[model samples]
Target: MGLLFLTIFLTDFFGYTDALLRFDRVRRKVWMFVGTRSPIELDWDRLTPVSQGITPANSNVNTFRSVLLVDLDAEGDVKFDGKYPRIASIGQTSLNEQQAISQYEYVRQFMELGPTHLPSCETYLEHRTVFRDIVRFFGFLDLARNIDWRRPGETGGGLLVLASILCMLLGWAFLPFDLATYIAYRCNRVPKWPAKIEAYAKDGGEMTTPVGAASGRMRIVLKEVPFILLWVGCAFAVYAWVASWFIK
Candidate 1:
């Protein structure tokens, strides 16, 4: 148990800490280039266009007029058109129509030309790589599950099993055991937080999952309970073994 606790403390603190640092580095890199904090959103944008394209393929007719004539309402969804008009106008705009046509043509050209400069391309590629790294990191879980466990001896097996158990136990102790479920509940109930706490004041205090509940529990059990129990067990075992020598 002494060995088990030591192993878990080292692995959880060092190994997991290293993994989290790498994850954060990739996350930061993705955010720095993509201009978004979310890695998942960044990944999605790479695979899917923010706005639909007005191509000859998607359009009914080959001519611009025919495509534009199809429907203004059908125009691709603008994600950040309001926020970044310059980027948005690159795809929107037309020569013939002043307001409507110009914007459409601008958008069309922007999509067709893509990013013009090398710096833009490099920035886009860097963000893409960061997104890919996030995906690959998540993929490692699958790889871990497939790894063979039988190769390790009894001591190794015990250590691995205990570490796995401790992680789960500690995680639950630190975080809300039902955190995922609580989040799901909140999502279904409120969907969004009220702009002001007063809005929900009429209804009892806003519900929050027992935050840090898991971490607190983990600290007590992993750092205190198990540490003491394991050390005491080791000491008792050592004393028992030595006592047998005297009796014999």
Candidate 2:
């Protein structure tokens, strides 16, 4: 029934097609609604992609969390502080690498062309990837299914529980980073944050600066001694609490 309603009336937004857009030509902005949450409005004048790249996915490597990082000017008018620019990331748990790239391309193209961009797919792959990313969200059920009481065997239950916990941790930890990136970008508060994340993925990060200094300042603020200490402290505290639940 929900799907039916969306198809009949909200298909454009769900399909991520031309219909999702609400343009005010005089204002020179565009809107996108993904159905489950409030729509996102974009002001083309203040948009720019600071960087775009992805890390390879691998199960054995804890650091192999795939990501695409982008910087935006949040408020879309002017920066209050020269010291602060904004950053947001997209990751594999939320989307495969291909989908993140598509997002960049779409936003980049949309800003470049104004509302006339009209949400297009250059190829079938592009369409398939978008729909696939949207559907992959439902994949979270797999974690819950693993926790079913009907299941037997320590290995199965424990592994699934651990996977679920890690998933939650990933989101919790990403929250600050993601919030820092988009909170100031839009005109109104977004209902749900962007699921995109640039996973830490590899040993040393690959970051490019399109308009600002070479991340030295951001590193000091986001990754330097003080923040890193707080992050590590919180992570250990959470791990200890969760471990206590199962150590017995």
> TM-score for each prediction?
0.17, 0.24
Q: lDDT, candidate 1, residue 195?
A: 33
How big is the positional error of residue 177 in model 1, measured in Å on the Cα after superposition? Answer: 25
List the lowest-lDDT window of 10 residues for candidate 1: 16-25
Off by over 4 Å in 1: 1-73, 84-205, 210-217, 220-248
Least accurate stretch of 10 residues (summed lDDT) in model 2?
126-135
Model 2, position 164, has a per-residue lDDT of 48
- Against the correct fold, how does model 2 do in TM-score? 0.24
The Cα local distance difference test for each model comes to: 0.31, 0.39
Report residue 243 deviation for candidate 1 (angstroms). 44
Candidate 2 — which residues are off by over 4 angstroms?
1-26, 29-43, 52-84, 87-97, 112-248
Give the Å error, residue 134, model 2. 17
Compute the lDDT for candidate 2. 0.39
